[model samples]
Every structure is written in C-alpha cells, then in structure tokens.
Target: MVQKIVHDWATGKIYPHFQFVFSFKFRDLNTLNCSINLSNLIVVFYPYLRNALDYIWKNPERLLFIFDGLDEFKSKIDFADNCTEQQHKCPDPDVRCKVSDIVYSLIQHKLLPGCSVLNLQPSQFLSGFLMELLEREDSVRSVVYTFPHLTIQEFVAALAQFLTVAPRNIVKLLSEAHSATDGRFEVFLRFVAGLSSPRSARVLEEFLGPFPNETTCRVIDWVKEEIKRQAGNTWSEFGKRSLLNTLHYLFESQNPALAQQTLGSVETLSFRGLGLTPIDCAVLSHVIRWRFGLLHGTVISRIGECQIPRARRSNPASGLVEPLRLLMLPTSFSRDYEFPM
Candidate 1:
C-alpha cells in the first residue's frame, strides 16, 4: 500500500481512491494517540476512507465487512445493552470515537444498515457474534472434530522411542485404549524426559543451546520439564536406540567432529548459516563410544566361548580379513580403502 502511494506520486499518476483499503491491527491501532477518528485518520492520510464510507452507504444490502480473528484485536468491544442500542443508531463514520465503537456500530447494523457482517471470535459456540449477524434466523450450521483419538496417537508416535512399551504392547495399547486416552498422553512429556535420564535435561539444554524462535524455545522448555520429571521414574532401555539414531544423524553432518560436542564451545554454533545450536555433540560421541565398547566386549566374549577353527577362519572365499581392515580403518587408511556396499 505504501509502495503504491509512493509510485503514483513519482510517476505522475492519480491516486486510486476506489482501491483504498486499510487494516487496523492490534499493534497498528495502538500507535494512534486516540481512537481512530477523523483527526487520527487524516493524520496517516489513509487514502480517503470517506469514499469507502460513501460506497458502503450506497450499497447497504449484502454483508460488506469480513472481520477475521476478532480475538486478536486487543481493543475492548462494547456489547452493553445501552451501548448496543446507541450504536444501533448507526453513528456517523467521521464521529470521534474509539475504533471499538466503530466495530460495534458496524456489528449492530447501525453504522451500515442492511450490510452483512461476519466476525470470527475464538472458542465460543453458536449464538455468539453469529446470533447478532443471523438475527434470530431459524437455521444455522456447525461441525465438530469427531476424531478425538488422533491426539493420543500423535503424542504416542512422537514419543514412542522414549516409552518402555514394546512393539506388541504399543499395538495392544493403541487398539484397546486409543479412545480412552483422549489427550491424556500430552501430559506425559516429562515421562520421555525420565527415559532420557542418562542424558539429563540440563545436559539436553546444554546441547540445544540458544533458540531464536518461540517454537524451538517452547519445545526446549517442555523437554526441560520432562527431564526434571524423568528423574523420579524407573530406568528403561527404550531410549538407547533413539539416542544412537540422533548420534548417527550428527555423524553424517558436514563437520562431524564439531557437530558432536557434549560441552559445546562458549560461542554459539550454527549450521549452514541457519539458526540451530545443537544440544551436545561431545556427549553424543561419548555415548556412541560407550555403545561400541559394550558391543565389542559382547562380541569378543562370545567368540572366546566358541573358538573358531583356524581352517574355517582362513577360508579364502570369505574375504574376512578385508572386512576387518575396513571396520578398524584409521584416518590415514581412509583414503586407501573405499569398500563396496
């Protein structure tokens, strides 16, 4: 809108009065010293809204104003009996009053008679603004979300790895109690935190670092809450694989060495100029090493229990030594070996 106004001035074109439209949002209206009256209206020179008044005045039949998200407007709207009756008189558009009064006037049909108005407010049933708009009409329409079970499913799926429920148990729980749960699972985020115990919530926070957005911050806050909650829960092996998966994803990143830091550098870290300060790469690497150690010990112990016959181990067609060399290959040996899938 600003660009259009500026362009007309620069290019020797007349202002488009018919195209003039203005939206006074919560923050925008707060800038006015007083309510949006003729004085403040002209202060901004919003392309002659008088023309809009005139146009709407002439065509008072069908609904003209479509006000969406009325809950977002911080201004207090007047719905008192006397105020409603007075505004029903359709006060002058130029009248010096609050913007809320203007909206009330429009809503009551006093401001612009015969014109239709639809206002959408939050979390209220029928006979709200609809009652005034529909004016005692016999018929109205509405629909409700019938699938309340979906919320439970979504919450469970998101935190499945954190829960100790096995595959069969999860399937049984979903089938038997899906409807009964009805959003109760949303409260169990700390349950997941308890499972991520070895990696405490503080440790997780240390990994996530700084978030530049509300969404990330909210997630981090919930996770922190879960971590504290998890401290009281019993130990579960449910989250070990999930932790490994997180480490694997980090290992595949461009700078794996830096990406996997438990106590990340004091200065904030970013990936590809995007705002992502990962929690702890060092801890992840440590966890991976610990897992490897356990697996190595188990494998060695099993091999010791049943000694391999030297003749079978030396079978030429097995290509066993080549695979071993790849498994323990050093940084220097990386360039020398490029094994097939």
Candidate 2:
C-alpha cells in the first residue's frame, strides 16, 4: 500500500515535468523495453520513460529520474555477468540483448537529450561509483543530492497512519523508555521502528514478535510498565511515542532497505560518504571485531566435532568447506549490528 502511495506521489510530482529520460538497473532490463529499443530491454518500462520525458518537456520542473538498487545490479553483474537473460523477440528493433544492456545504453547516452540521471544504490558502493563517474571533466555532480535515511519527522509521519497515535505521545513514550531502560533503549526501540511498507513492517514485526514466547512478552510488558512508573507518567505514556524519534535514526540507519521502501522512489540511496564521527567508527569497529571473533570460535569448535575424515577434505569437489563456513558465520546479536547500515 505504501509503495502504491509513493509511486503515485512520485508520478504526480515528478513525471511529465522533466525533458529527458534515462534509466539504469542491475538485472536484465527486459521489463522496461520500448518500441524504439525493444530488442535491448524489457518492454514494461516503456510507459514510465515516455511519461517521464513528456512531463519534463511539457513542464518547467524538469525531471527526476528515480533509479533504485543500481548498486545491487552492479553486484549481480560482478557476480554473474550474464545472470538475467531470457530470450524474447523484439517486435520492432528485432535485436536481442539482455535488459541490462538497454539500461547501460541509456546511461551511455543512447537516449534523448536535456535529462538528468539518478542512480540509487547502497550508500558506500554508490559513493564509490558516483565518485568515479563524476571524475570526468564533462560529468555533472553537484545536481545530484543523496538523501540519508529518513528524518525523525518523516518517520513519524510515515508511521502515523498505522499506529493511530498522536506524535507527541510517541515522543513522550520514547523519552520515558530511554530513562527506564538504563541505556538498553536501542534494543527496545528496534522492536517498534519501521515504515508502513510491507517489507519494512515485516522486519519490524519480526523484531517485535520474533521471540513470541511467554517469557519475551512478559519482559516487554514489564519493561513498558516499569518505564512508565519510573518516568512518573500515566499508562498513556506506554504508547508508541518512545519509538517515534530515535526509531527514525536507529531503524533507518540500521535497515537501509527498509528506509528505501519507506521513502519511496528516491533518486539516490547510499551508505558511503556517511559523516560518521571518528569516535563512532572506532566504537563500531571494536564491537564488530569482537562479535566476529566470538562467532569464528563457535564455528571452528563445531567443525572440529564433525566426523568427516581428513582425507575427504582433499577431494576437490567435497562440500565440507561450504557447510563449515555457514556453521562458523556469526549468530550473535551484536554481530548483526554491523551489517544493517
């Protein structure tokens, strides 16, 4: 539902207002092919490009090209060069190529003129690619604006519909929870933070409901009540307020995928170039390394107990290594904190 809302919003605000059209995707771009170049891409994306360009040429706002997961596509390409090919005859161009081929062509200037391009991808990866792309003397960089994870206000507004709670109440609850948790607030807040998108909400619900045993519920309820009492506030204080603000920062930073879903068809999404303070990076690195070590130890011990003969390991095609790798991968809570951002 939120995806629909955002698509509508973006189309209303951005489409038919720009002059040029350019798009890029990571996979076979077969779904976005058009009659003009149907042989090189997907056909489903044709209307989008047509409408977008029409809006740009007919209106003054220019156009905003919302490209998503370019980094993911790049990763896919790196891992499997010809990953998403499905043969289909083009009605017009009569040529045959993967969807990714078409997207690459557009980005390479096989499309119309007077257009801007927005490449969305993971922050760190996007930063590196954009830096490289912008290095050329004719490349334009300043027009691009990379939006960070959603702001506190945007988060609040996004969650407001599903929560049915006033903004102030949410804020008050978070404040009270923070004071009562004795600094375990980050863990608690994770349970309630998320946008209304199905994927984002699913992640949030899992956090909240993952451990649904009686003991977990009791802990949650007790914490809520205790926080309310300690904060000297009414039971109303136990509402969603505590989750609203810190969640904006915590959930968005913790789950960029969720952030993208919540924010909708944005031009750029990236984790690189994040202005993390030196102290913050230092602390994060320490925590990550410690967790990695603990998980590594657990894995090595598990593998040691396995009864596989040493000579079997010498078999070139033996699968022992893969399972051992999985067994050793970190399962600790602190370990996962490093990846979500």
Candidate 3:
C-alpha cells in the first residue's frame, strides 16, 4: 500500500495539491534529539520548508508524512506509557519533547491531528501476488515463508521488472542498486542481467507471459557500458568487488560473446581480502577463460574455504601457458593450483 501511495504520488494520480509530502526512513528519524519539536525538526531536516512553517501549522491536513521500514526501528513504541498522557494534553506542535513522544502524539491524534501519517513495515503484505506465494494459514496458525535462498528472492524481484507493463529504466535502477551500501541489490542486479538472455526470457514466457524484448536488450547494453566504463580506472577494494559482481552478472547472462567484448581489454583482476563462494569461483573462471590472453597477474587472496576445482583452474584446450599465482592462502590449501587463465 505504501508503494502504491508512492507510485500514485510520483505519477500525480493522488495528493496532487499537497505541496509538502515528506517520506523518511524510520531509522533516520530515530537519530533526532530529544528536545526537538516538530517546527524545528522540519527546518533542520528540510531548510526549504522553513518558509512554509506557518502554513504547515495552520493547514496540517495538506501535508502527508510517510515513515518506512518500521521493522528496523530500534526503539519500541509504548502507546500506554505515562508520557502519552502528557503528550495528549499538550496539543501545540511547537512544544519540545522526545522524538518518540512526537511520534506517539502524531499517531494518537494529539499532534497534527488533521495530517495523514503512513507507517510501513515489512510484516505487512506488500503485494497480493507475493502474499499468495508466501502466505499460508492453518486451523491454529498463520505464517509467511520467504524463498529458500536469498538468490531466489533476488531473482523474483528481477523477474518483477519484466512482469510490469511500465517501461523500466534499466540504467537508473542499476545506478540506484550500485549506490546501495548494504549490498542488498547485488544479486538482484545479476538476476536482471541473467534474465536478458533470450533462452531465459522464452522459458519464463511459457509460465509467466511475454517479457518485453526491448527491456532485455536495454539491460544487456547497460551491462556492457558499465563494464567498459570501469575497465580503464584503477579500483580500490570496493571497486574490485563491483567489477567481480559485474563478472558474475555477465556469467549469469550466459553470453560468451558479450563477456569477451566487454572484458577483452582487462589486464589485471584482483579480488583481495574477499570471501568467495563456489559459485563465485565458477563465475571468475568464466571471465578468466574469456580474457586468458589479455589478462595477466590475477590476484586472489584471503579465500578461506572456497576451493577452486583443479580442472576449472586450468584449461588445456585454451592452449595458454600463463603461470597462476596464489597469494596468502590458508594452511589447508597452501599447495600451488593452476588457474585456467
């Protein structure tokens, strides 16, 4: 429902007249000082709103406040606390109080009674299709089970892009995902890349419906541009991880020609102080095979238990004779292993 509201607002389908519609993450709100009042808070967070403070005070109903990710809120909300009684009687929006008190007052209709407040948490059903897939009920209990693995969930999110009628801006979505600090969108981006394959699209169409061929092509093109953009610059650890993720996305696409074209000029590949899964190793091997002649000095360090298969480590068919170097390996797998590149 929050998403729907946001979408409607964005498209000017609802709240068209409202000039002050503020959306804030619950975690960001929790950082407010205890003595801050609604009036000061608005100016502190949004200085432009300072000019409209009097208007806001008089016409609170015109403003819509949306608080998202309540499930991640660190503080508990106690509706029956003694502080509620004090807050309820103090109806002035400018009165200084704890941020929690302000939240309670707002919810209880004591402060900004005419304004609308929307609180969104993950426990609430976000989509009917998702509810149908994950929600189950029995005689005594109800439960919601997520996909067995994180990758499956990410893939489903990626699939949702094609299922929607609206044209997806692949570059914008990728940019947003790339900027996220939590690594939440890493696998989802890879799945988006994988879904670009015609074989994958046809398989999905058999069960879901026809996917927009143009969107898939756009994703492929974006992936190529991203790889090319990063190829020239020297990368730090974080950037190296991003390059590795790009390799994974390319491998997921299963387009050998695309991989070769995008990564043909890559000279050195370094994945230092990073944990690698068996799947990650496989993806790395695919890139190595493509750029065997051009790539030199591939450095992998601090890979604890991720064992690269000896056969995959070397490819005799490629007829390449570049000595592979393993640096700072764990005691268990200290022996020299040939890398295909």
Candidate 4:
C-alpha cells in the first residue's frame, strides 16, 4: 500500500495531503457533545477535506488514514466486541454517532472498508529517522563493519540527548539513566558522562557548534551526588552497580578533584558476587590509581577471582593489584555484580 502511494506520488498521479489527528484531538471530539458525523469531523479537524467529501466517499480505496501515537490514546478500542455491528455501523458519511462508535466502525472496516488504516506508536514514528540512516551508503557500510558492537550506536544516542535535551533537565535524564538496573544503558551512560568533560565538549563543538556549559556542569554535579549516595550503600547490589557506574562516569570526565572529593572517606571496597568485566576492571583500576596511587586492603570474593586475572591479562598496566583477601564461593552461588575499586 505504501509502495503504491509512493509510486503515485512520484508519477504525479495523486498529490497526497496530510491530515494530523493527535490523541488530544480525539478526546476533544468525544467531549464536543454536538453531532459527531463525518462531515462535521471533516469541517472541524480536517478542514482541507471539507469540499472533497463526495470525492473521498466515492474513492475510499485511494484514502490512507494514519493513526499515530496509539500508545498515548486514552480510550479503549475493543476489537472483539460487536458494539459496531452492521446495524450500529455508520454506513452514510453524514450519519451521526458517538466518537468511539465511529472509530470502531472505521477500524472494523464497516465504514470505508477499502481505505488503508495505519497504526503507529511513538517509537515506531521515531524509527522513520533510523530508516533514513540505514538507507545511506556510508551508514550501511559502518553498520556492516560494526556488526555486533553497539559502541557507535550508544555514542550517537548520547549525542542526540545532549543536542536535544535542555540543560535543566540533564540532571533528571542522568538520574533516569542511572536508575536503569538491566545494564542496557551502561555504555550509553558512560558516553553521556564522557561528553560532559571540557576536552570532550570542545572536540564535539568543532563539528556541532558550541556545546552548552550548563548541561556539562549539571551532569558533573549529578555524578558527584550519586557517588556520595552510592558510597554509603556499597553492600547491596544496587549500590554496588550505581557506585561502579559513577566511578566510570568520573573516570570518563578525567576529573581528579571530583574523584578525590567523592571517594576520599571510603576505606574498604566490596565487589563480592558482581561479575566484573575487563572494561569495568580497567575503569576501577584507573579510579583506584586516581584515589590512592596504590590501593591496599582490597577484598574480592567469588566471581572477581576469575574476572580480575582476565582484566589483568587484557591490560597489564591496568594495575589491578592482587586481592589481599580472596574468598572463592562455588559457581552455583555466583551472581552478576559490579563494584568500584
């Protein structure tokens, strides 16, 4: 259907006109209390179609109705119910009925049966931009080269957030990113934090004009507060993950003073059940070096016993000191966890 429409548009056979109907407009239609017939709907919401009502009715097959942001639609659409049965359907274009009934009849194909109806959610609407990106030759080549790695994707997402989001709301954005426990935003959060640094911001400014200083400051400040909060609760899994995340953010910023202010009072660090990745250990090693030059009295229990050696092998200069106390638990008891050095 979409291909045919595009072909028609290209060949100048049909000039498509867009009629926008937001979710709020549907609510308004329901509350108007006046006759909610097709002619009135055309006159009120789709004014351009008012004069072409007869033409539209005669050639309903040529019409395409796009219902976007279906996720935000408040009213229930019961597909199984016979509420819009043959007798209740609005057969005539000018027939009056409840707004919901009209919608039901349209969707159930009792009205304008030959017309195309497209339903889309917010995410699906945004995916059109990604489709454009995928259509580009350079972007396609980049995708092929980076097959499984999501680093570029994460970086682009971070960049998009910075470019679009306001400085005042940056704190809230970071907070929401930090609160995600599934680790889906882990690398993305790190990119966001890395972009907060003056050096990184300056690099970005060369291509995208002046980056906002207020947003960077807000992100930095939010990281500090999170570190402070996570430092006090390092025993729990959530605290361990959050503290590790903040440390990565801190390391990304390359701010020694921020690191010292946040981690100065901490004596002992615990990373028991958390499975430390090489990247996690590298960040941990950097943060530890930044804190004490050489961290002593470190305790790594269970899974860290295996991960630390691998992290050390990957980066010998990571300076992952031998654990003073290594308690190895059985594999059955192991759980994924994270911690700061």
Candidate 5:
C-alpha cells in the first residue's frame, strides 16, 4: 500500500502528502502527516505528529507503523523536479532515472544494498485530487471526528495565513457588502487556488498588478473629467437623467444586463471576426456598460450577430463561465465579415 501510494505521487498522479491515523493495542493510537525519507536509517525512525484522532481509530494492526515514523521525516528531501531543503537533496545528475526506478526500488527487493533514488516533483498546491479528497463527505467527517472542528474565525485565520495577507484587511473585507463579502472572497480564493480553469488565475494576475499610485490616480481624475465633459455635451436633459439612473442601477442593483448596458454606452468600439459564446457576451457586457462606454449598442449588436453561431442563445447566463473579467473572442476569423445590427 505504501509503495503504491509513493509510486502514484512520483508519477504526478496523486498528491505526495498523506495523513495516517492508526488504531492499535497497548501503544497510544496516533496520527502522522508528512513526506517520506527512507535514506536515513537512524534508530529505526520516530513518529512526527498527528492531524486528526480518527486516523488512528480506523487502522488497528498498522498502529505500530504509526509510531515508527521513518516515512514522516521532516528533513529537506528534494524530489526530482524541485529540491526540498535540509535532508532530502535533489537527485544527482547520474541519478537521472525513470519514475519506475523509485517504484521498483521501494517495492521490488524489500531490502536494498545502497540508496535508491528517484525524482519527485512537488504537487500543485490546489490539485484536483486535493479538492475532491478534501471536500469529500468521508474526509470532512474524518477531520472532525476528533474535535468540534474549526470555527469560521479559525477558518478565516487559516485563510489569511495561506494568502500571506493581514487578517485585519481580510476581516474588514468580509465584514462588508462590497466586493469582499464572504462568498466573493471564497470565490476569489478558489480562483487563486487554481483548481479548475487556469483562466481565473490569469484574471487574478491582471487585477493584482501594481496598484494605482499618484500618477495613476491623476490619470483616473483626468479620465473622469473628460467623461463628464463628454456627457454634458452629448446628452440631452432627459438623456442625462436617464444616464444617471443607469449609473445608479449599476451601483445599486445586481442586474448584470443593466450593468452591461450602462457600461456599453460609455464607448464606441467593436472587435471583428470574433465568435462570442454566451460567456463572452456576459464579459463584454460587463466591460462596456459600467466600466467603459456610451451607446455603441448598434456596433455591439452587429458584431454579436456576425460572430456568434446561429444556434447559440444570446443570453450570457446560459454559459457556466462567470463574468469575473472580460474575455476576448478569437480574432482569427475572416475580416471581410462586417458587424451586423
């Protein structure tokens, strides 16, 4: 079982980290979590630590192995892809062997003459395996079998540590109704965790660029003044009132369509030969109505017709994609096709 687990991790098919809980006779039941380090044959090995109580309760015969913690060594053990610090170093150049080498070494002889080495890469922190395993019903139950489980406050603290941000900043954000609400923040973390699409990570990358400084703020002010000037000239008295109403709706109501429309009117622009899926529509709408433009609706409508496939619905909500950021459609289509209204 141990060899199989190690082999899977080495091949990038499974996560390397494992938490073992043992139930036994005489000795105290315990749980241990960490990576393996077989090189050091020091005094037969020692048990490191435990995560949850139930880990020990489930496996009784293997309880001796629980206390024999050779597998849970904490030294800097480097795998093939990335070098770990302290004891386990990266494989030597001469040790450039296939992944099967480690598997064979561990499982084949049951005893070895010298050090048998293999390259192991650090797993992606938020891999699919972790998400499924951690979120599973059994897993959560196993975790809480020991205690009452962490409170929301504890969860928030853990998140802050993982994010490397001050708890105060996160607390303030979560305490309000603005972009930092609990759901929004969880969504944000899930995105950063890079579990599903890497696209969300890229969106986060864009938002995380150097924040606005004095020069940027000045530019914002200049842009606002220019927009105000344009608004005064292009809008009639009723149009101005309606525009203000649109702005209010965007800020107040959660209606994405209204927000999109308001943003679209702020600019006149069109991307050509683009095939917009429903996802693209939501993103495009968000960018234009509130953030960017003034009634380029005719242009948008024309492009929408030309680019989107006939069978697809025009409604953006049909797509599973969220409008966290704008997504541009592919730009490789024929240029001769004009936008249709």
Candidate 6:
C-alpha cells in the first residue's frame, strides 16, 4: 500500500505533499470531531502549502523538519508502537495507523534515514507521542518558544465579514435571463468570477481551476453574457480591457471550443487558399485582428501560425492538435512550411 502510494505521487497522479499525509485522520474512537478536524485541516492547507518531499529526499540528513504549533496536531497517537526501524520514507510500510505511530516510525530512523526533526510549541505541550519518541531517541528533542504577541482580534474582525456575508451569486441570476445564449456568457462570468481583476484571477485559479466540466461551462457562459452586456466603444474603455482578460482565461482553460465560441459572428473567417490574393491577404489579416483582437500574444501567434485542417470538425477526429508555439502552417498544400521567427 505504501509503495503504491509513493509510485502514484512520484508520477504526479496523486496529491503528493507531506502536510497532506500528516493531515490524514486516522481511525480513533475517542473523539467526535477526529474525522471532521482532519478534513478541516485540508481547508487550512487549501490557502497555501509547500511540497517538502523533494527537498527532504535530496538531503535527508541535512534537512531539519520543523513542525510549529504542535497543538494544531488534533489527532491522537500511540506513542509506544514505533515500527522498529523500517525502510522507505515516503509512505512507510502501511498507513492504516495513527499520526503518532507514523511519526514514531520516522523518528526511529525507519523513514528518511538521518533526517532530524524538531517540534516547537507556545508552551509545555504534552503529546505522549512526541515525549516518547524524544526519550526513545537521544538526538531528538523538543523546545518551547515564547512570542511577544499575535493580534488575533484584528484578524478575527477582518474575517468576520466574509464569514457572515454571503457572496453575490450572479451566475444563478444571469442563467435565468440568458437561458438561450447562456453558453455565450463565459467572458462576463470570468470577469465577475475573478472579481473583474487580474490579481483576483490569479488567486482564483487555485480554487476554481479544477472545477468539473459542467460547472466550468456554465460559469464561462454566464461570464460571456456579462461581458457582452457591458460591451461598448473602447474610447474610455471599461469593457474591452476586462473582455481581453476574460478571453485570456478562456483559452487557458484548455477547452478548445471556448476559444472558438467567443467569436460569435465570425467563428470561421475562412482564409483557405484565399491568402494568395492581395485583396484577400489584406482583408483576412484585418478580420483576424478584429475577431481575436483582444487575446494575448501567444493565443494570437498560435492561431495565426497554426495550419487549420480543411475542417474544424474533422474526420477520424484526431481532435485539435496542440497549438505549436513556433510551428507555422503551410499556406499551400505543401507540408514543408516556414515562417520568419
């Protein structure tokens, strides 16, 4: 079981982080909130987390694992049952064990040999697991550090609003109004969803990026509607800039259709074989710029250089080839195509 878990994490198939493993709620009959607290620790890990496995792997001996605030370690441990020094650091032999039992095994020089660990606390913390492990090993020890003060009052005051007030759910409202063309509202929803700001979008990527396809499509649709509703001339532009940012988000979604869907009237500005004509070259260039005028440079570059197959919806349906960043599609039927760098 341990080996299997390690293999999966090494291959990037599972969430591989030390905190993730530590946060696991082992089977315990003592507490009502044991399981709930473990899952809630996940909420704590959600905001910011560091994957320390790689660094630990590289220098097991030199690395010192500092686990601050031991009081936060909610689950109980069986301090006596140290796995008696076994091999394998990542998952050990089994995970069907308590947090303390696992930490005990690691402390016994069973997992990640030569690695040292130190525990810090606000006061004389008494976890049998830590005390037993430290006594069991001469090198291991614990220390209590004192701090001046942490202003939790101000933090709580700031956090109270978000905890009390509900979010403005525009998606449901827009869904009702734009039922028929709801799919076309991704731009507007993206703007609103990100709080219509670049900084907000970056933060939201973690929370919202991994949403399922159905939810993603719906949010994209609602955003599209909002963008269209706000569209106007770019002289004192408010909408155009937001529209551009949202369009960038759409392409980043890796959903090919959303990229194509944004061009309402000019889904296919077909330039097949027509680029040879002077008038066609001028007109096609203009059309490309006008339709995809708001997208980022990479999107524009890929779209411009990529060889569109004779069909958008094609046979054998190899699906859309990944946009080759520097590959140019041949204007003619010849496969050997080249464009200036």
What's the CA RMSD for each of the models? 17.2, 23.4, 17.0, 13.0, 18.3, 18.7
Best by lDDT: 3
TM per model? Answer: 0.29, 0.26, 0.47, 0.46, 0.23, 0.26
Across 1-341, the per-residue lDDT of candidate 4 in tens digits comes to 23443455456654333222212234344456655776677678667867878866776655555454455566666666554353355766688876656666666667766554555443231222222232212231121212134676787677666665355677787788789888788888888889888788786665454666677778788888988888778777778778878889999988777888888887656666676666776676667656653444443323533333112112358756443221233343246433333
lDDT for each residue of candidate 2 in 1-341, tens digit (9 for 90 to 100)? 22332354356642333443334444433243433353223234555454343334443235334455564563222223343443222222335444444344333333323234455543222322222223212234323433343343243333332334223245456456566634445443444433422455565444222222332333234333433333222223232233222323333334333333332232211122223333333333332223222223232232222211111112258644322121221332222111221
For candidate 3, the TM-score is 0.47
In order of lDDT, best first, we have 3, 4, 6, 1, 2, 5
Model 1 earns a TM-score of 0.29
Local error of candidate 1 at residue 118 (angstroms): 11
Q: State the lDDT of candidate 5 residue by residue for 68-144, as single tens digits.
A: 12223332223343322222221321232332232233222222222222222221222112222332122421221
* Tens-digit lDDT string for candidate 1 (220-337): 3333332233222313322322222233323322222233233122121111111111223333323333322222322221121221111112236976633221121113311221
Model 3 root mean square deviation, Cα atoms:
17.0
Candidate 5 lDDT at 99 equals: 23
Please provide, for model 6 over 180-266, each residue's C-alpha lDDT reduced to its tens digit, 9 standing for 90 to 100.
Answer: 343444433333343333343445334323223343444566555543543332233233334333444443333344434555443
Instruction: Return the lDDT, model 1, position 89.
Output: 38
Q: lDDT per prediction?
A: 0.36, 0.35, 0.65, 0.60, 0.30, 0.37
Q: Candidate 3: where is the Cα deviation over 4 Å? A: 1-132, 136-152, 166-168, 292-341
Candidate 4: residue pairs that collide: 274-337, 275-337
Q: Evaluate model 6: give its TM-score.
A: 0.26
lDDT of 4: 0.60
For candidate 2, give the lDDT of residue 140: 43
